[model samples]
Target: MNRLAYHQGIHKFFMMLGLALHISKPVWKHLVHLVDALTTKRFSGTLTDVHHWSFHPNHRTTLSHFFTKSPWNEERLLEKLQEWVLRQIERLAKRTNQPLFLSIDDTICQKTKPSSRATHVIQGCDWHYSHKDHQMVWGHSLIWLMVHTFTQAFPFAFRLYDKKAETSKMDLAIEMLSSLKGKRARPVYVLMDSWYPSRNSSKPA
Candidate 1:
């Protein structure tokens, strides 16, 4: 299908961004197909070979490679997204008098199977204790920081939580909060769950 033509509105917006400049044509083609498949409610399966022929000439293997072992800098893309989101927020903040709410949370995303390819190959996929599931699940641990205005909650900065990484979630939250040192919203209030508290017992949540 000519998804670009089919979804011209979204396609034009994506193309207009400086973010689109970095992607090569072949990679961009697969990326667009993946976006189309993912956003559609009916085609909700893993981007594997089952739906490969339905879209275009590229195989599922090619698409999988674009996610993993690909040379693309997803971090840079995220930074671009951050830039774009803040610009939108700036427009809305001028109209609202509410203090911006910066919320932080972490969740466990369980894998299909313990030893599945996703658990092995996907970045940040691992064993984590899921309080929601009440089990040790093999999958990704994800943490995100979101900005909540009166009408919207925009999840902007997200990072994979790996205990093997450089720092703890507490540290990362602090770092993320620090990044908003001089936001247009004054006195940004941080809303975190019970899990996050000062290590010292004497302090309040």
Candidate 2:
């Protein structure tokens, strides 16, 4: 779950793809270092770690640009990530009898800064009441689709829920399910907490 394990293989995947897509080597290096810092428990989210233990040298300002204004198709990148996830799940399925689980859930990641307010309009960040915190919080409400094969879970897709967009959390889950139809994974049991399950949870009969 930390940088060491992921950097061994996943970083290589990103590097090769970045090269094929004509991404600058620096961008590719930052991509790996960004993920490394984010997943690391030691220096998590600190700018110093992203210079990557002095492995790659760059200013902290670069990360802000990499996250917000990077000229890449996020949706396409996510699709490729999902493809890799599915392939791994399929490989794991061959070794286990456990049924594949497709789970849907969401959370509010509250933003606490004025500059971070950019997410307010652009990335679906807003005030949403949180049962966990017992009050409204300013942040993005993001829902995810993940696949599990008994031993592990892999994130497949995501949707940012904007109240102004009029899409309910349940609706976002259903959209992911619909979009996944005709894919290779089958016999996927839908998993959810009490808040999400309903007679309408599944597609129309």
Model 2 CA deviation exceeding 4 Å by range: 1-10, 15-19, 43-49, 52-55, 113-123, 183-186, 194-205
User: How many angstroms is residue 64 displaced in model 2 relative to the true structure, after the best TM-score fit?
Assistant: 2.6
Model 1 reaches what TM-score against the true structure? 0.77
lDDT of 1 by residue, 67-136 (tens): 7777776777666667777667656765676567778988776776544343346666667877877777
lDDT of the candidates, in the order given: 0.67, 0.70
Best by lDDT: 2
Which 10 residues in a row give candidate 1 its minimum summed lDDT?
Answer: 196-205
- Superposed by TM-score, candidate 1 places the C-alpha of residue 155 at a distance from the truth, in angstroms, of 1.8
Which pairs of residues collide in candidate 2?
none
lDDT of candidate 2 over 1-205, digit per residue (tens): 2446566665678754444375556566677776666665676556767666524457778877887787756676666677677778877876686678888888777776346445445355678778798888778888888888889998888888877765678888889887675656446788886657676543210
Model 1's alpha-carbon lDDT is 0.67
Would you give me the overall lDDT of model 2? Answer: 0.70
